[model samples]
Target: MLTKSSQSVATIKAEDASKNCILVFDPDKTHAGKLNAILDFLGYDLLLAHSREELAHQLKKYPGLLTIIITGDLSETEQQDIVNIVAREAEHILPVVLYSVPAKNEQPVSLRYPPSWVAVKYPIAHQEFSSALDRVHAHFAHQQTEKGQRPAHLFRSLIGRSPAMQHIRHEIEQVGPTDATVLILGESGTGKEVVARNLHYHSRRRGKAFVPVNCGAIPRDLLESELFGHEKGAFTGALTAREGRFSLASGGTLFLDEIGEMPMDMQVKLLRVLEERTFERVGGSKTIKADVRIVAATNCNLEQMVADGTFREDLFYRLEVFPINLPPLRERVEDLPLLIAQLNDRMEYEKHFSVRFSPDAVSILSGYSWPGNVRELANLIERLGIKFPNGLVEVNDLPMKYRSGTGDGVSHDSQLDFFAEAAAAVRSQPFAVKTKPTVAQILANGQDMKSYVSEVEKNLISQALEETDGVIAHAAKLLGLRRTTLTEKMRKYGLQRPREGRATG
Candidate 1:
């Protein structure tokens, strides 16, 4: 009977020992002992580390550690140092929980730290700590699932691992092999063309040409001839017979970019060709069969256009068979680091120059609205590569407006006024004017000349800043203004760098 009782006790102790352990680091030995006692009573194994070296040793010793809890006595710098060390030494990224006593004027702990890092106040109740720990565990599990769900490669050109991107990849996989008409919708610079190419590359027509035409860029009169070949002497400038996009893209894919910009008349013709799979060249009687897949993309809302009577309802339905909407850069901020890395790689390959962005620089970028989206990011990366050329991009290297998270610093009222004036100018001008309107003529039109001029000045400054990747001195030089004068204007316009006390260099 005694032997059986001893075995039962040993088995209970062994089971208790098998529970997951948490590593705690506290400078105050008494406080540490108190925490250990509390945790022990709650059936958790605890490992205490009093110094940096001891913490490192404990991390290795407890490979199956559930989490790390740090007490509030450490300064911000010390906390950062500990985090850095943890990041470097850990076999994998670990969830970190910080316990700090808030100052009288300090913001809430939740607001001060990101969601990925749990922050709790000192004198934490057992139940509160347990709840926080449960949340941390759930977050870590979700991260692991997300990591597993990521496809090895979505496409050669597209790069992202967020859930949004994963959905897009799944859509592409389902739709790529089919000959269905696809409509890609997104804002400008959101990689619509890249998506189209991926679909084409994966389709049955991969061996054939992938032709892309920008309907909005070509004149309406020439668009018809561009889509369908024009015969010799078909028009005043037709010197010889030339094939259109349809013939060039036969047995392949035809990408209609900015398709919403197609005129109403052209939409009818396009609908007819799509329905019949046949079209005739301009001034030619031959009916050419179009053995091509259609992939249309537009930044404008086709449904809205149809409702507005600008786009044909039938054509919209035909193209909307398979729709894919790309999330904007701002929507997928988690992909910024990956994007930055890819852009750096591309810069190195194409320009033979590269630059690395500091973590703070990336953090600042991730907070911006990214109005121009991925294209804007790519442009900025290229500019950075040119400027730094194998240098590190610190937060101060970012433009004042970007650093400040205020894009171009244009007031909402001013922006509205600028657009209003531009629309009015367009409405008043003749569609087929023989010559450009002079500055005086433009001012004579119903526009506040001063505001219009100021808008133009602001636009110029914004463009210069964008071109220089927010470098003040470079922008000032491009504008032929003294650096101080440019700085004054930036201030006057409410443009400020992301952070103060950082050099504008």
Candidate 2:
């Protein structure tokens, strides 16, 4: 039994006892002293108590006692009460013995219980007590070993410990154990397939296959046959009967990627399959029962599609019985480091050359919005490994497009000219083909608008340069022009002379 406070009703000195041994009992002061001394002399360690109440409370604090020696003889009902407490409340397996002082006339009283414990009288052989204690310790050790050897497949594969990930993990935990339909919503390049895999692996259908089908990839005429299978000769090219994703995944999970892209007519067929758990192959008479689980994902606004009548509202609700929404990479920028580390590990395991991203490289990465999220990051890292194998990827090593903010490394001048030319095209469109010109237009009709446009560009460029502290790169950003374009314009307008005085442009 566990030790209670020092102010226990009856206390023992607690001398040299094996770590595996404990003694619990209720005894009068005189009897308690005698019992403690005898047990000490006999090499038996003891934990004492004033009553059954104290003993039961102590048991909660310590676990696994080899033997318990209950000291005085109580009534049969009282003895059974103590036994019940030990059987139900003990932390781990502990063999128990009821010890009583030698009786005046006949044999001492003994109580019986299940095989888990033992009952013995006092003045018993020392060897008998020690042997029973050893047995209790062995039982607990064996049980712990068995528990440690269970398989890893019992849990899902998605791994992250951050608070944001924890919330996502908890949501997955709640639904992964059930058979409910799942809907995953996120922007493109987020790992929707990974989440779907986690849901399938953690569910009761783990051992079965996970079939993923992209609805947008198939043409309208072929999509129905692709999803629902088809009988022989259903179409011109149909030479034999074929099983659709639903039938193929009958005992597992079917993940529909970009389900919002599925045609409206096909949506009706899908709803029927979900509602009835049965479907008919194209040109087939028999309706086949399907036991497949559904895991659908989309980056589109499904509610808006439903509202616009492009998607069936009932089908949308059925697919969205449970939803898991993923945050965009920009919102979870803190996760970038961990994600990069994980990606690096994967690259190494694939036998790719080792690489490292410079601190400045990471800083640049963090500043961007990651329009494509994790998938885009993964691709970037893989590309870096391939391009700069066995080397450090400094900020300068980054592709020029990414560093320049265009994502395609086009020359700064070319980007500016593209935008300026596009603006010019819109301005030059015929505004009035047959309308008569006003007197002011007749007077100025011969003047070129080109000079006026150049003057407007010059004034805006000078203001942007002043606002940016004369940093041409920053000025270009402010004016939505490339740095090179801004420099060229500054020269054309005689504004590029070295600034020796305060800017007055």
Highest lDDT, which number? 1
List the candidate 1 regions with Cα displacement exceeding 4 Å.
Answer: 1-156, 406-505
Give the Cα-based TM-score of candidate 1 against the true structure: 0.52
Model 2 agreement with the true structure over 1-505: per-residue lDDT tens digits: 3332222423533321223235557646445544453333222345776677777765654443435656565777877877787777763555565455555997755554454666555544434443443354444444444677321211223433334576777888899989899999999987888899989977998899899999999998999998889999988999999999988898899999999999999999999999999999999989899899999999999999988989999999999999998776654544554566556545544543445654345555655556788888888888888897645676799876567643423223222222222222112122122343321232243332233335555777777776777777777777655466567678878895344564433
Clashing pairs in 2: 401-409
* Backbone clash count, each prediction separately: 5, 1
Error of 2 at 121 (Å): 66
> Candidate 2 — which residues are off by over 4 angstroms?
1-162, 404-505
Which candidate has the top score in TM-score? Answer: 1
Residue 387 lDDT (model 2):
91
- What is the TM-score of each predicted model, taking all chains together? 0.52, 0.50
lDDT of each: 0.69, 0.64
